[model samples]
Target: MRVVSLVPSLTEAVAVTAPGLLVAATDWCSHPSDLDVVRVRGTKNPDVPAIVALAPDLVIANEEENREGDLAALRDAGLDVLVTEVRTLEQAFAELERVLVDGCGLARPGWLAEAEAAWRDVRAPSERRTAIVPVWRRPWMVLGRDTFAGDLLARLGVENAYAGHADRYPRIPLEELSAAGADLAVLPDEPYRFTVDDGPEAFPELPSALVSGRHLTWYGPSLAEAPAVLGAALRAARG
Candidate 1:
């Protein structure tokens, strides 16, 4: 079955599970770098006409990464679109199954089970650390309540400082975030590209853990590595 994926994580998921199934994907879908699919543009502004031209049997998208209008446009064009909602690790696993098994009519991939097992093996560190995770820098938005990344960190004994905030990604003042009483600040490399030089300086008082955004925020085969990848980064930040 031919598929067009708009979400980066979902694109990687489908690509890894079933090779050559994807006919096209967004420019942001950077995993499996050898992926020779047609580029359909970015997630926020995908080329609708170009995607329709691909004649895909299924289009995979995420509710968080894609715009409703784009999905509606595809549906209006008589295309079957599968939209996934993943706010936590469990949701990601279940949704990946639904998108692959139910939506794509493919058997469950073995990697999915491995990814689940990897996360299941995670045991929270005895000493928990209060963390403030910043996703962006210019306006300074943070991981707030009910975010998948927040839940992942919580499992590893890193509590998100803004987990109780109303907004899932809230824009807080830089000064406020710096003084939020977090023992550490976790910075991811995407959506904002936080580097050791760029992000760590903002919170000099707090130890900074510069992490891989894909591992920290994305769900897919990466989920299997996220626990160890993020754990090591978070652990090193304390040292």
Candidate 2:
């Protein structure tokens, strides 16, 4: 079955699920960097005409990952679309499996199973609560509760400083953030691109760690190494 993946996470999925069936993909879909990737018109406002030209049997999209208008356009174009979202670990696994089986009819293999096993084995000390702010320095947003960012930290036995903040990606008040009283703050590499030199006042004096935004945020065979990699990084910050 020919597949076109709009979601970047699923780009990796196609690499693992079906060895050679992917026909087109978005620019944001950058894993296994050897495939013939297509030009991205935009993440949400994708080049509809180009995608239609591919004439894929299926398109893997996400409700949150894509713009509603693009989804509507795809529907109008009479193309089959499979939408997926990752709010929790279970939902994450389910969505990926659905993409694999429904889109390619392939079974979840070794790497995926290993990734799940590693996640379940996590058990960090409760005393060292982590304040994982996926630092987007510009416009400065903090990842609050009910988000994949918060969920990833939780698996490492760390608690979110904004665990109860109802919003998914909320604009944080500088004063409130100063008072959040977190032990460690993890700065992720993308969507905001925080670096150590950005320094203290905005970043503060607490223990800091630099993490991969894609690994923590991206879900696929890449997830296999994230739990262990993140666990080690989080643990080092606590110490």
Candidate 3:
């Protein structure tokens, strides 16, 4: 199909659904392992001219990741672009369904049904504890308001604790996290691997756990299996 993907999760979808069909992708697009064989075009702010010259039949972008200007430039170049957005677990499923059914011409896998059944296995949640998930390092921000991750946590019966913030991922003082009195501050292990051991030493008062970032955050084919996994983790954490 000569697909060029600027977003990582979409890249994962294309690679998983139709391997070797991808012409290029951002440096961040890594999933299903085999996609590692594809050529790296660049990051989210990819070289548009380079992509245009690739002469792709389909270009995948995200409403959240790439800048509007970048996407507009591609549109101006007359390339067919598909933009996906993921803000909730349901929305994640919808996006994946769109990519598979519309983009790749594949049926939704049975894993989604399995994931739903597994979620049904979960006992009705009784609590909504607070947590702060750190998605990045340097300036130090938490998964705040209006993010897919934040909404996923809410689905698991946990609150962002910083949901009313001005930014989806606002850089906050570390001390403010402690003041939030979160039950746990989850540390994601992709984009940066934060281990459970590092938890005690780093954010002492707040019990912590190392988690797969994509599982909780990436909204694509991965969502087919996420609820079962994340639901289990939340059940365990509350125990």
Best by TM-score: 1
- The TM-score obtained by model 2 is 0.93
Ranking by lDDT: 1, 2, 3
What lDDT tens digits, residue by residue, belong to model 1 across residues 7-80?
99999999998977999999999998888899999999999999998899999998989999999999999899
Q: Summarize candidate 3's per-residue lDDT along 1-239 as a digit string, tens digits.
A: 68888888888877776777788888777776656544545555688888898888888788888888888899999998888888776677777778767876667756555555654555546867788788776667788778888877777777888889988888987777778778877778876677767667657877675667888877666766776677666656542
Candidate No. with top lDDT: 1
Answer with 1 or 2, whichever has the higher lDDT.
Answer: 1
Give each model's clash number.
0, 1, 0
Candidate 2 lDDT, 35-137, residue by residue in tens? 7756656577788888888888888888777888887887789898888888887788788888887667887767778878878787766665758485575
Task: Identify the runs in model 3 with alpha carbons over 4 angstroms from their true place.
Answer: 112-124, 235-239
- Model 3 lDDT-worst window of ten: 115-124
TM-score (all chains, Cα) for each model: 0.98, 0.93, 0.87
Candidate 1 vs 2: which has more TM-score:
1
What is the model-wide C-alpha lDDT for candidate 2?
0.77
Of the candidates numbered 2 and 3, which has the greater TM-score value? Answer: 2
Predict model 3's lDDT versus the native: 0.75
Judged by lDDT against the true structure, how good is candidate 1? Answer: 0.92
How many backbone clashes are present in model 3?
A: 0
